[model samples]
Target: MFLLQVDEEIQIKLLMPKDATALTTVLCANQEHLKTWLPWAVEIPSVSTYEKEIIPSWLQKFADNNGFEAGIFYKNKLVGMAGLHYIDWRNKTTELGY
Candidate 1:
């Protein structure tokens, strides 16, 4: 897991299953504001969704090195996530999705 410190109160690190509840909190809290830009914004209903589906899939992709998802923490709380999806090794290209 990569840990980066942006400032005294902000940090960035890989998102893990253990962070499900926190991630869910961030998502739920910003759902209305995020819904316009994020298609999956309304899909997360609870931590179970993270435990059973979301986190698992993200982990798989990270393991494969195809891409990964990271959490943006502010004051020790998850505030958002940034996803790096589908690295095209041959072309050396990838897109950062947030």
Candidate 2:
């Protein structure tokens, strides 16, 4: 849940409709910043893939208490995105990937 950069006056919160625009902007701006570890990276126009693909998957997982996704916000704007992935509640541990 603690995704903010150290010493940064910002916070990470659940992705909301209001964050869609900023999130899209950052994703585009930082495409290179992400491609190293993110395999699904693509040169997409608009935010449809994120809205149509990423969010849906994250929402379902989060709802089932199997994941937690959030936008990294700096000064009230989304600076990046991160999440907890591959959660295994039964094992008393969740792989924290953010």
Candidate with maximal TM-score: 1
Instruction: List per-candidate RMSD values in Å.
Output: 1.6, 3.4
Candidate 2 pairs with clashing backbones: none
Candidate 2 lands at a TM-score of 0.73
Per-residue CA lDDT of model 1 for 1-98, tens digit only, reads: 67889999999888877899888887888889888887878676689878788888988888899998888999988888787888999999999987
Distance from true location, Cα of 51 in model 2, Å? 2.5
lDDT of each: 0.85, 0.70
| Deviation of model 2 at 44, angstroms | 4.5
Off by over 4 Å in 2: 1-8
Prediction-by-prediction clash tally: 0, 0
| Residue 86 C-alpha lDDT in model 1 | 88
TM-score for each prediction?
Answer: 0.86, 0.73
By summed lDDT, the worst window of 10 consecutive residues in model 2 runs over 1-10
